[model samples]
Target: MITEQIAKDIWELHSRLFDHRPILQGHIRAFVKEFEEKRGTREEDRLNKIKTQLNDMTDKYIPETETALDTFLTNIQAKVKVAVEVCKKIEEKENNIEVGFLDLQRQRRREEWDVFMQEQFEKSAKVDQDMDIEMKKVSAEYEELEKKIEHISTATP
Candidate 1:
């Protein structure tokens, strides 16, 4: 008789547990939903904080980066300008050197021509002097021969 009562109590407990399963499941689902919502909220808050920090960093550094880049570009431009000026100076010097060389060459050629003309003038003067001396000698010899012919004619008469 006692065993029979224990078996009846056990069967009633099993029936109650089965009847409450749907309610327990509903509560578990509600708890899970609440937990998921809280987690999502925390994650959103963390992400928003990261976004704000990133925005602050960009705001703080963007102008500095732009200023540095501008400074670098200005320096490069200045250097380029200086380089161009230096190149022009170098070109001017080179041109001056070339012109000076040409001038020197022209002066040397002029000097050479002057020396050659002086030499030719001296040679022509020497030739003219020699021709004049030969002509004078020939004229004196012709006069002596004419006098001899006249004397011979007079002696014959």
Candidate 2:
């Protein structure tokens, strides 16, 4: 799952050697050109290491996230399935709602289960949304990193 800490870490790491923020007027492509034109060979190894880490961010960490999110989403789906099954057992046809038929015991149970499912759904949705946002940020950073690496690669000669 894409925890808040991981998201923050991802942004922090990307910010170390490059700027990954919104651009208002200046062009990133032009900035890369200027960077390449001005870059010196004083610390080539450090630059290479940074490049490698960037690559790993896309290759290793991103895929690992996919697996983690897949598992997380699967678990959430299971919870939803259980909720649906339990909801089906409820005989109530309350319009625009999912509650059990009005027997004292069943009604109380219905309210509890409905509330539980609503909370689960909301929580799942939030996590999914956050994961998607992080994934987008990672993708944009990876692409920008690739551009920088290519510039460095060609400009070195």
Candidate 3:
């Protein structure tokens, strides 16, 4: 009995082979190459010979173990399924690592900007403090000068 999974796998391979014609010229050539390999040497005699052999085998042996081929193909597909899942996991992890790298870069930039802004703010604050101290000294000197002029004017008068 042919299972549904076998049918689905066959459909997938058929679709890849027939329904989805590849876009690249190289891929088309590769397909032709593979077909020629399978069809035997681009010669009619070779193809006919292969056909006769296949027919002979089918007539002699295929009836006796029909399910064996299907089971073997299905088992190979099961192994392929595991490999595909592992490859998907590896791809996902690689994507996550790329995202993490970008995020880390952004974080470092943010921290650098914060440090630069903090340094600018500190410099501004220091300048303000120095201005305030200078203003106080100037005010005190101006007051003392005013009092001296007033005393000198009183004495002279």
What TM-score does candidate 3 reach? Answer: 0.40
Q: What's the lDDT for candidate 2? A: 0.84
Off by over 4 Å in 2: 1-102
Q: Rank the candidates by lDDT, best first.
A: 1, 3, 2
List the candidates' TM-scores in order: 0.41, 0.34, 0.40
Candidate 1, residues 103-155: lDDT per residue as tens digits? Answer: 99999999999999999999999999999999998988998888999999899
Residues 53-129 of candidate 3 have per-residue lDDT tens digits of: 99988997887577787779899999999999999999999999989999999999999999999999999999999
Clashing pairs in 1: none
RMSD of each: 26.2, 49.0, 26.8
Query: Superposing every Cα of model 3 onto the true structure, what RMSD results?
Result: 26.8
Greater-lDDT candidate between 1 and 2: 1
List runs of model 1 lying over 4 Å from the truth: 1-91
Full-model lDDT, candidate 3: 0.90
Whole-model lDDT per candidate:
0.94, 0.84, 0.90
Candidate ranking under TM-score, highest first, comes to 1, 3, 2
